[model samples]
Target: MTDESLVRACQTGDREAFSALYDRYIKKIYTYVYYKTHHKETAEDLTAKTFIKALEHIDSCDPDQRFGAWLYRIARNTVIDHYRTARPALEIDDAWDIPDTSDIARDADARQRLAAVRAEVQALPSVQRDILMLRLWEGLSYQEIAQIVQKSEGHCKVIFSRAIRQLRAANALAAFLIILYATHSI
Candidate 1:
């Protein structure tokens, strides 16, 4: 069923509809939270909290609105609240789980490059970083990102472009790594 129909059913007290919506968005919400938190447990907790908040406020949801964007907005807010309440303890190991490769030297080199790129990306302002991740990693459109970030689509594009430019100006290699990673060629 369409999200609108599912939301309508959920508003009418259809538990199954809510379940369906949960199933549809669970992975996406979890991934988005995980990207922000970097800790599996924290991501899981925050993702659950986001869903809970959505469920509680589902009645207030406009069926005519885009559900995915609304869900992302809740997730973004939940992460913001998490940060506001406490600084998250991030472990390097938790941030990435690269598989073992046959060429140890090549693997080490790639990991080092990836680390540089990650650091550069992390240096970006939260808004720009979030916009970049949503645009590249999540493959979300500028329109969807604008709704989630509560900014104009043109503003999001400018932010994303400026983020890339900053990365390139910081390190050409880092920019290349970002491109490789975004295209899943890394």
Candidate 2:
């Protein structure tokens, strides 16, 4: 069923519909939360909380809005609230327990680069990061992101543009550091 159909069913008190919604979004929501908190336990907890909060307030959700965007907005707000209350340290953990050391080593550099980018993105102001994640990571359309972030579409577009520029700048800085390290090594 389409998200909209599931939402309508949920509105009419279909428990199965809500479960379907949860199943559809839990991983993405967890990923979004994990990126922000950089801790497995907290991300897992917050992901559950996000769904709970969404269920509690499902009636308030607009039927016209895409349910995925709505769920993501809930997840984003839950993570922000968690950060406010917990003030958890954000550090990327590089340990992935894949059995093959060779495979792990092969991807280690790429994983480290992604972690650095994630850290840089997380360091952005919440508004910018939220919009960027919703647009780029979640693959929401401008209008959908605007709806989720409670901004005008034009404003969202501007914010997304600036956020990308900031990410590019951060990447350039990382490149410069790598070059400096290479020169020092030789």
Candidate 3:
């Protein structure tokens, strides 16, 4: 069923329709929340809360808006509220934080790279990172992202373009450091 139909059913208190909606969005919502918060447990909690809040207020949502964007907006707000309450600082861990060097080295390496990228992303002002994440990760169109972020679609495209440039620069620096390390090792 289309999201509109599912939402319409949900608005009338159809439990199965709500479950279907949750099934469709849980992973995307979780991923969006997890990357923003950088905490697994908190992300899980907020993912649940986002859906519950949606269920509670689904009637208030405009039917014309894409349900995915609406759910994402809720997830974003939930994460913001979490940050407001926790006010935790972001910390970068050393490369050796993963203890199992043999079995998990590949996974660890990927996670380390992702962590580095996430750190670079975190350094960006929230608006830019939010736009990048919505566009790149969530596969949201500029128009949809603009709706969620309350910006013009043209402005959203500009923000995403700048964010991509910033990410490219950070990646280039990382690549340069890797080359330096390899040369030093030799």
Scored by TM-score, the top model is: 1
Give a tens-digit lDDT track for model 3, residues 1-186: 999999888888899998998999999898887766555666788899999999999998877788888888898788777655543453222112222232322343345656556556756668788888778777878888988888899999888888888877777676787877976763
lDDT scores in order: 0.79, 0.73, 0.74
Model 3, which residues run further than 4 Å from truth?
88-111, 168-186
Itemize residue pairs with steric clashes in candidate 2.
Answer: none
Give per-model TM-scores: 0.78, 0.70, 0.74
Q: Which stretches in model 1 have alpha-carbon errors above 4 Å? A: 87-114, 172-186
RMSD of 1: 7.5
Q: Could you give the C-alpha RMSD of every candidate to the true structure, in order shown?
A: 7.5, 8.4, 7.4
For model 1, the local distance difference test gives 0.79
Tell me the tens digit of each residue's lDDT in model 1 across 14-125: 9999999999999999988877766567788889999999999999999898888899889988877776555345312223322233221223343555564666766677
User: What TM-score, to 2 decimals, does candidate 2 have?
Assistant: 0.70
